[model samples]
Target: MEIHFTKMNGAGNDFVVIDNRSGIYDDLTKEQIERLCDRHRGVGADGMLAIEQPVEGSSSQYRFRYYNADGGEAEMCGNGARCFARFARNLTTEFEDEISFDTIAGPLVATFPGEDVCIDMSDPFDIESDIELSLSGTPQTVHFMNTGVPHVVLPVADVTAVDIVAVGRELRFHEHFAPAGTNANIHHVIENGHIRLRTYERGVEGETLACGTGVVANALVHHQLTGAASPIAVDVQGGDTLKVEFEKDADGNYRNVKLIGPADFVFDGTISI
Candidate 1:
């Protein structure tokens, strides 16, 4: 079957978006997703997204279903959600400055501010210690938080020196996280209250230019450690700066968490299966 898809990117993490509200295309398989994501042999992308009609009275009228290049469905994707919102808007030409949609992680709301998209990410779960494997016989001091998806945030002295591919794989597959893995993020605090980060995503399985939710996770972890709030700037390995805003209640629950970053349109085309 042949399908029409849009290629989009947020920061640097890219995706192939398909609109399935018409239900015209069914029978999508993992192998097809993988083939389409092949960088050299096919239309390469980090993952694939499908836009479906949201259930009645949903925060919005579209539901985003995401699959990694491996064809496995992920609970949520921060960067992908931004791309999904943009794709949906363009598909219907029904643009809204703010949009709400549902994902496996629950309802997500996003707002377009100027030329950027900011998403209200899920509140984080602050675990006292690393629930999974610690850093290679090192102490278990990493902060655990779930912003859309589970992430292991490790503060480092120099993020650049860290081998993200190797260490990230180790943590992502740690037995504690089990059958389903988690994304790994390495963070370093830069000057003037900015944090630098590199993330190894679970589905993509490598470092991308930027991760929307990963940036939010890093910012929240930084705030937990440093007690700073309001807004935090995150420098991603992709060389883009993502701004994060949140409110910490008296009990330290992170609410009103938002990630602001660039969502750009690369180009669009149709493909055959």
Candidate 2:
């Protein structure tokens, strides 16, 4: 089969996006997807995004399906969602400034403002703070949250000083979060409402240039720790900054969470599989 796809990136985390609404690419296997994401052998991306028909009874314009480089389906991906919105808009005339899509996480609404795309993220839950873990015989302090996906955020003194792969891998498969592992992140607060972060993503199984949900996870954890306000600026390894905004209710629940960042088109091509 020859598949037509668009290559896109949000911040620096990239993807291979296909319009699957026609059901043309429905039979793509996990192995095939893994090959497609292979850096040297295939299209080379952090993951893949499929724009499919919305489920029955869903009012969304389309359905969003995300696959990690390993070809495993994920609940959500913040950066990928932004790129999905842009890719979907350009493919059809039915959408303009705003678009809505359904994902494993839930229905998400997105808007395009100039060159950036902003997504209304699902409300986060299952928050745990100051959890102590023993890594390499050293006690580490981390926070946990479910921002569409499970994540563990470690506030480090210097993000660059940490061994992302080694430490992140350890935390990713730690028995503390067994079975369904968690993405691991090490972040440093740059200022009152700004932070620098490096993440070892779960399905990607290694470090990527950026991660959308990881960014939001760290931002919210920062707010929880220091009482920082909304609209936190996060500097990712990709050399781009993403902004996260959320409102805290009187009961300390986070709502209206939004992720704003750049979604750029890299290229488009047809590949044989």
Question: Each candidate: RMSD to true structure?
Answer: 1.8, 0.7
Give candidate 2 misplaced runs (Cα > 4 Å): none
Global Cα lDDT for candidate 1: 0.82
lDDT of 2 by residue, 1-273 (tens): 888999999999999999999899999999889988999999999999999999999999999999999999899999999999999899788789899999999999999988899999999988999999999899989999999999999999998888999999999999999999999999999999999999999988999999999999999999999888889999999999999999999998999999999999999999997
TM-score of each: 0.93, 0.99
Q: Write the per-residue lDDT of candidate 1 for residues 133-155, one digit (tens) a residue.
A: 45688755576778878888888
Residue 260 lDDT in candidate 1: 84
Q: Top TM-score: which candidate number?
A: 2
Those runs of model 1 whose alpha carbons end farther than 4 Å from true positions after fitting are 56-59, 129-134
lDDT of 2: 0.95
